[model samples]
Target: METEPLLLSTSDGVATVVINRPARKNAVTQAMWVDLAARANILSADPDVRVIVLRGMGDDFSAGADIGEFDTLRGDATSARAYEATNSAAFAALRNCTVPVIAAIRGICFGGGFGLAAACDLRIATADAQFAVPAARLGLAYPQDAMGDIVWAAGPQMARYLTYTAGRIDARAALSAGFLLEIVEAERFDARIGEIARTIAENAPLSVRASRAAIRAALSHDAEEAALAQAAGDATFLSDDYAEGRAAFAARRTPMFKGR
Candidate 1:
């Protein structure tokens, strides 16, 4: 029997997290969610990792949850809430990581898979990628945390459209809904994602981190969110990377940032 199949590997300052259940189109099990959260934490704490790429094995990305377990694990509201706790841990770990995350999507992304992609910092998919949320069909109400993630990526309106309709959307429509940043041809997908990830990895880490935090707080009125965003900016101003960036600009040479 196959042991847990989630994979995390880091190389050249970039970390790649792969969902390895291609047989199910990477359908996520609760155990996989726990493993994902742990791996994300490990990646978050690694100073050498400048960027993260999230992907799935085989021809497609994830097809969402392993609904087969619902009868045993999520048969009721309390049980479902318990099941979603793992999802919250995994997605929140990815979202709250200081480093940038890129979701490299190739094929189907449905239900929870769509939620995961939306939580990432950027989503780039192939032209053939498809997305949907089937909450309506299942007669399930999205918990606040999951709904908040959809709202954060798309918006209140698009989130409602997706949840209420339980309809499939193509890559172009997903892009228009703010669910995807770019859609490349299938042949060009790998090269395109590598190019983008390299660009982010080579940039000043502090500035990029600050930009990410501030943008996350852009529409938030919460005091804690405001304070966190302010701290990200303030810390960047005092970072050694700030000094190196300035000197490198003046000297007209590529600045090597050590993420100081």
Candidate 2:
């Protein structure tokens, strides 16, 4: 598929979606958001795709949403709603995918870029990664779902601090805030991402999908939250992979899972 603002490549059961606009520091365009969401849906439906990696082209992950598009968003209420919907759809697609999504972040990850990373199941950032949410600086309200992700990763206090300050934080600070799963030096970023992706791909797809769903549900504010955990545990216990795992352990060999 030919997408103007993004590039999609699938190989070895991993689908990599790359933000392609290097000149604007990979700032997301409206069309790009729509296309990305569509591509994500397609990948989610494909059984052969076990994982997805989101990254940016050029040196930076993303500068943020394209400021140039603000004219359309600020023009009127209808335009604003449309614009917000596009971004929300893109985020929803990422969040709702069955397969795991990893954000391989390097350099600057700001505003909408940070939102994108927050949508992923895991984030592996480079030591030099810089993060910020400048909605306050721009006098714009952060989207609720985006804010929720921040609050879920970081605490409400840290989320508020980041939003209020609109200041950049380093990779270590992000990791400390619980936003990053791992941080690696720039020299090892690519190899580290590959290793992590390979590890995820080797797992049983059914268990991974169930785990992703349960984890997201547990993060929500539902009253019966423990049900999600119970469902996840039950699903794994009932899966054929569990038996294979035990058999392999007994045989002293690695088990091959078919995701059944």
Candidate 3:
């Protein structure tokens, strides 16, 4: 086991979270799920973090949750629900993160791993990446908390296909289904993720966050959330970063946002 099964590193306003079990294709353990939620919550609270990227070490992103623990952790309905609750917390943390979260995927991404990717704001996978949700194969139900993300990313029909068949789909198929933002060759995968993350990090943080909030609020159809999103968007115009953006536009120079 790694000293840190999940690793976090930050630079230039982008934080990378690594699932570090390459030998097992980075399958997440129950403890790792808890750690994932904690890390996401902590990073989201950090004003310095403009973006977050989730990936795995070595060739694969993740194969999904560790099945070996199922007999103990998810052996019965009571324990299964508890286990899924932990999974839901992790998914919710990523979905609700203030900064945009990107899933940098490659190799096999299945079951819970796919759920995590679906929860992200964006997904970029290698051309050879494979995806699936194998709950049916294991004779188990998919996590309910993550269902919305899968539906939102892949649409209802595709989500049904993934869930019902438990079949593997390639990156191109996922991209066509609206699950992936883009796909790159395996060799260029890391570079592409870096480019996108940097582009987001360089943008005005307040504006980016406001946009994210607004989009989510619109989808949620909750009046309170809509109002909050409106407030956030309105606040951005009065921020120092907004002033800098306007000044830079007038000066014909790039904006340096303070995220104020």
Candidate 4:
């Protein structure tokens, strides 16, 4: 089915979510934010989906939040709060998803766009991709969650540079800053992205999910406790996928994971 702001399709255990407002460089609207949150919720619950790939419909990933919405937000505290909540919810959906999310970035990834990319577990960008957070230019402050996401992906120093100057960085610089997993030339971007997605899909689903959960837990402050670490390790040991993996190794054949 088609939606106004987002287009979603699922096949071969992968869900593809495309931002559809290419005429405006896919600048996100309030409605679009709601749709994104909904889509994330749906994808997260789909047993058939092992991975999610987020991308823009046309040349650019997104220009940022639609400026036209600002007028409605100005001096309206309730409206502003609601908008922020919607955006935050959308980002949270991506972060909390059981399935891994990948950002396949192309042209511009700015402001909200950058935040979205940072929320994904992996990012594959074209050589021509450009990244920025232009809150400085707009005389606005980013929310703590957004700031934390940026810091997590690119480190404090890089996050500071991007937010302070509101300058654009090329794909290579983004990779160096740890904002992207890899950068491929535009001509080869699609093939490379597909290969990565297929590789992930071919893996045992339960193992992948457990790894994602463990990584997220380890990144959180609670992970500093020895008890939590031990608990997580024990859980992994008890998982059926772990048993299947060991058995497959002994059998000298590929293992099939049923996500048990």
Candidate lDDT (C-alpha), each: 0.86, 0.85, 0.94, 0.85
In candidate 1, which residue pairs clash? Answer: none
Which ranges in model 2 have alpha carbons more than 4 Å from their true place?
Answer: 1-3, 223-233
* Per-candidate clash tally: 0, 0, 0, 0
What tens digits encode model 4's per-residue C-alpha lDDT throughout 45-72?
A: 9888999999998899988788888987
**Tens digit of lDDT per residue, candidate 3, span 195-242?**
999999999999999999998998789898899899999999899998
Backbone collision tally, model 1? 0
Worst 10 residues of 2 by lDDT: 221-230
Candidate 1 regions with alpha-carbon error over 4 angstroms: 1-4
Candidate with top lDDT is 3
Show model 4 residue runs off by greater than 4 Å: 1-3, 223-236
RMSD of 3: 0.8
193-251: candidate 2 lDDT, tens digit per residue: 88888788888777888788778777784656557656766788888988998899899
TM-scores for all candidates: the values are 0.95, 0.92, 0.98, 0.91
TM-score of 1: 0.95
On TM-score, the candidate that comes out on top is 3
